[model samples]
Target chain A: MSGTAPEMGRRDGSFEREPARRVFASELRECRYQFKDGEDEKSPTFVLLPTGERSNRIFIVGTLTEKTRQGEQNIFYRGRVIDPTGTFFIMAGSYQPEAMQQLAKIETPAFVAVIGKPNLYQKPDGSYLASVRVEAITVVDKDTRDLWVLDTAAHTLDRVDALATSTSPDIVKAKEQYPSVDPAVYRKMAYDALAQIKM
Target chain B: MDYSEVTERISRKFSKSGKEIDRQKVEGKLRRLIDEFGVQPSEAERSVSNELAKEFNIPAAGSSGGTGAGAGGATEQKAIAQAQPGDWVTLEGKVVSLAAPASPAIAQSGIIADESGGIRFVVWAKSNALKMKEGAWYRIESAVVDEYKNIPNLKVHSGTTITEIEKTDPLIPEPSPIRDLRPGIGSVRAKVIQEWEVTHDRMLQSGLLGDETGTVKFVIWKEPGKEKLAVGTVYSVFYAQVDEYNERLSLNITTATIMQEEGDIVTATGGDVEIRGAIVHIAPGSGIIKRCPVPGCNRALSRQNYCPIHEIQPNFVYDLRIKGWLDDGEKTHNILLKRDVVEALTGINLDQAKEIAENNPLGMDEVFLQMRDKVLGRYVACKGREIENRLLVNTCERMHFESGEHAKLLNRAGGAP
Candidate 1:
C-alpha cells in the first residue's frame, strides 16, 4: 500500500480460463461481477449461467429464432437463439464475416449452435447487461439441439447440487461472487426442457 | 584463606622505616579492596602490595594503565564497522558472502560481519589460510584492517589465525524485498507466483518469484525423483546462482540449493500479479534463433555458435522468440514469448518465420517488424513469472475484451506473460 511494489491480486491471471460455459440470456443479464486488473489481463467477468453453474465462458446451442440489425449501417447483426428455457443473444460484427455469412444463409426458427465469449456491462442501477460475442455460429439438426439440451441440463443440475450442498472453497468462492444465488429457476428450466421428449 | 595472615602481610608492608603505620587504616584498605572491589585473590595480592607501596612512600613496581596486550596476545573483539584503518583487529563473526578466486594471489574475497555491521574481506593465497565456510562464525585474529576508497576491508595474510568459534550463527540479512534485490545476495525467499517448464540443459520447472520490493525468475534444476515447488507457495531459497541478463538480475536454482516452504514466515506473498498493458516497444533478441539440437540442451546457441554442452561442432534447430515491453498504465514488464507460444500469438510457425526471414534482406529484423505490427500498441494479457522487470511468458494473448473472456477464448490456461 506504501507503493512497496506490485500486489499479487493484480497478477492472478491463470484462474477461470480452463473451461467455457453454457448459460442463458436472462441469467447473463441478471448476473453482475466483473474482475479486471488492466488491459493486459483478460479480466474474467464472473457470472452464474442458466444451467446454475458459475463460470466465465459460456457455450450455447438453440434455435435461430430471430435476427435483426441494430446499427443504421447494418454493420452489426444481432440474432436470438431459443433454448428450451430462455433466449441466448448472438451478436456478430463486420469483423466476424464467416459467422455473419453463415448466419445469413440460415432461415428463421432453425436449430443452431454458437460458441462465443460473454460480454458483460454493469448498468447504472447495479444490474449487468449480458451478451455473447459470437466466434462461430452453425446450423444443426433438431436431434443435435435436443442432445444439447440434455447435456446442458445435466451440467446445470450437477452445478446446482454442488452449490446447494458442497462446501468446497471453490464453490464457496463462486457463491460469494454471486451473493443472492438462486438455482431453483434453472432446476425448473431443466425439468421443463426434459418434458418435451416425454420419456 | 586466612584473614589473620592477610592482615599481618598488609601490616608488614606498612611498617616501612619513615612511615607512620596506622594498623586500622592498613586493614581497612585491604578489606575494601578484597570485599567491595570483587578482585581476584591473586590480583588482589598485587593490588594491595601496590597500594601499600604508594601509601608508605615507596614507588610502585608497574604502571597501572592496562595497555600491555596487543593483537594475538589476548583476543580483541571488534565489530566490523568499528575496525579502523591500519588496526590489527580480531573479528568474530560469520562470512555473509564469498567470491571465488579471480586470480592466483587472492584466495577468496567475501563479506564478514558481526551484530554491528559488515565489511569486505580478502584472504590471500599465500596466507596458507584455512578454508573459510559461509554461514559459520569464526574468530579471526591479527588481521590487518585496511581501507580502500574510504571503504574498510580486512586484509588477512600468513600471520593471521582463523579459529571456528563456539556460538550461535552470526545473523545474516533476510531475503531482501524484490525491488531492493541486487547482484550478490547468496540466497533469498519469495512466493512462487508462477511456475512452468523451461529448458536449460534439460527440461525443468522455472518461473518468476517475488516479494513486495521486487521479483526474479528462478529455475529449479530438474532432479529425477525430487518434488518441485508448487505455485502459490512461499519458500526460503538458499544459494540461488545470481546472474545479470540485459541488466536485470536472475537466479538459477541448482540441485544443492535448499528451499523450504515458509508460508507464513515471510511478510509478503509477492502477491497475485499480472501485466495488463499495451505493447510499447519490441526488445532485441526477437525473431528466429538457433537452438541446440541436442535432446536436453535446447539453450539458445550464441552467434559464436556454440552450445555449452555440445561445444564447437553442434546441431541446430529453429525456434521462434518474441521479446517486448508492456506498459500497464503503471509499470512496464519485459516479456519473452518462446517458440510454440510465439507461433500461437503471431500466427507464424517456425518454418514460416524462417521463410519470411530468408525472403527479406533484413532477415531477422524483418521478422521482428512483422511481429511488431501484430503486437505494438495493442493490449495483451500475459501470464507468467515477473522477475526483475521481465515477464517470462507462459501463456499470452491479445486483450481485446474490456472484461476477461472464457479461458477457452485464448486457448490453454494462462501464465506470466
Candidate 2:
C-alpha cells in the first residue's frame, strides 16, 4: 500500500503510484480504447474499460493455463491466466527481467495472481488485442482466486453502478466513447464470475 | 412617489439645463440603482443626478466619485480578545508564533497576543505588508477580523498596514512534558534517540527525541545558520510548534530556538500495540516485488521500472510483503506484513516463491496468486507500532475460525442478490 501519510514536501510532476484495479479478465478484454490525459511523455496511458472506468494498472488472480517463451536475446515470457469469465493474456520481457525469469519457471494450470499495466494493440486485420504487461506475479491457491473473484465482482459492479447513475467526467467520457455499453451485461458478468468461486 | 420634482431639482442645479429630462428614464434609473443594486435611495438620487448632468453637457458633481463617503475612516484600536468577527480594528500585539503557511496565498499566519489573550492572524501575500518576525511587536491597522471554527482571525488585506514596533512584554511559553504537548507551541528538553534521513531539502533534520517522560518525533526545518543536531545530545527546544497528523504528534522547529543543555536524560520509548482484525483489502505491490538493490535505497520500483535516484538497475532485489487494510468492526487500520510475518501467515516464504516461479513456466506471478489466495479474507492478530495510519507489523498470527462460520459466510456470499 502507498503511505497514507502525506509527504511534507514534494515537487510537482513527481511520479504518483497508480493503484492496481481489481478487474475480471472478461471485462478487461472488452477495453479497446486508450488515451493519455497529460501531454508529458512520462504520463501514464489509461485503458478505458467498457464498465465506465479507466485502468492504467490492473490486478487479477486466476489459473495459469498456458505459457510461451519467444525471442532469444530479448526474450519474452507469455502466458494466459484464466478466471471464471475469461482468460487474460500477459507478457513479460527483458525490461522486466525478474518477472520474465519468474514467468519462464512457473508451472502451468496453477493458480496465480498478477499485477500489471494493460496495453491495447491493433492487429493488421482491424482487430484489437488486449494484453497485460506483467510487473509482478506469484503463485496462489483456490482460496486466493476465490477471494479475487469476489473482489473483482464487487469492483465491476461498482463501475456498472457508476455507469448508470454517475455523470462524473470519467464516466461521461466512457459513455461518449463506448455508446453501446449495457450496464446489465456487466452486472450479469459480475454475478457469473461470483458464482464460479467456491466460497 | 414621483421623481419629477427630484429630476427638475437636478436639472436646475446644472447651468444651461434643457427641457429634455425624461421623467420615466430618470425614474427607471433611480429604481434600478435603489432596488436591483441595493443602493440607498439618497445615493441613487445623486448617481442619477450625476448621469443626468453629464447627459446635459454639465460637469458631474461631488468630484465624480459617488461612494467615496464611507472610505478610509479612522480604525478603532482594540485588544485581541475584544475584536469580534467582521470588525475592522487596529491591533498592537507581539507575534507569539510563526506557523508555516498552509497555502501559497498566505505569506504568514500565526498567533498574535495583546494583554487580553492570543488570537490567530494571517497576512495575505497580495497585501504587500511587512513580514512580522516572531516575538516582535507590530501595529496592524485596518485588519478585517474573520471567524473560523468559532475563533476570530485577523485577516491582513491590501488596505491593512503592518508596522513593526518595539518589542512588547514577551509571552513566555510554558515548558511541558513530551507526551503532554498538544497542537500548540511548547518548550521541552529532550535527547535525540534516533536520527532519520532527511527526505526533503527543506528539512534540515528529523528524528526521534525522547525525554524522561516519553518520546516524540521532531523535525527541524532548514534555515540560515542552523546546525545539524547530534544524536544523544540533550537540547532545550523552546517554542517548538506541535503539529498533529494521522493522530500522532510531531514537533516542528521552524522558528524554535535550540540550545544544547548540560544534563543527560534516560529516554522512555513507546510500547507496541496489538490489534485483532480481519484482513479486508489487500493493497497493490504486495506478494513478490522488486526493490532498488542499492545499499541505502530500498524504494519499491514503480512504472519508471527503476529508482528515481539510482536510475535503471540491472539486478533488482526480490522482496516479499503484504500491505492490506484490517477491519476490527469499528474502523479500518492499514497494516503492513513484512516478509517474515507474511511467510508465517501465508506459509510461503520469499525463497519458496522464487523457487516456485523458477520451476513453473507461468513464473513469479503464480506465487503472488498463491499468496493472495492464502492471505486475503483471513482473520489475524497483529502486534506492531502505529506509524502514520499504518501498523508496521512485526509479529502476526491467524485467529482461529470455526468451519461452521466459514460455511455460512460462503453461502451468504454465494447466494448474492
lDDT of 1 by residue, B194-302 (tens): 6654666555677777776666777756556546778878877654445555466676555323556645434353533566655544555677887877765677777
Worst 10 residues of 1 chain B by lDDT: B408-417
DockQ of each: 0.02, 0.04
Query: In CAPRI terms, where does candidate 1 land?
Result: incorrect
Q: Write the per-residue lDDT of candidate 2 for residues B1-417, one digit (tens) a residue.
A: 555555554444442333366778887888777778988654676678657755765544322222222322434689876877656678899887777798998999987877665567888786677888987998887676766544567888655677788876766544578978755556789999878756554678888888878888889887677787899899888767677764578887766767798979888756458887546456656787777877646667763458777788768887888887665433456778888999998888888988886797767667766776576545578997776656778898876534454454444434444
Q: How many residue pairs clash in each candidate?
A: 24, 30
Which model scores highest in TM-score? 2
Look at candidate 1 and tell me the lDDT of residue A63: 80
**DockQ (C-alpha) of model 2?**
0.04
Best by DockQ: 2
Candidate 2 to native Cα RMSD, angstroms: 14.2
- RMSD, every candidate, angstroms: 19.4, 14.2
The candidates' interface RMSDs, in order, read 16.6, 7.8
Per-residue error at B314 for model 1, in Å? 5.6
Deviation in angstroms for B280 in model 2? 15
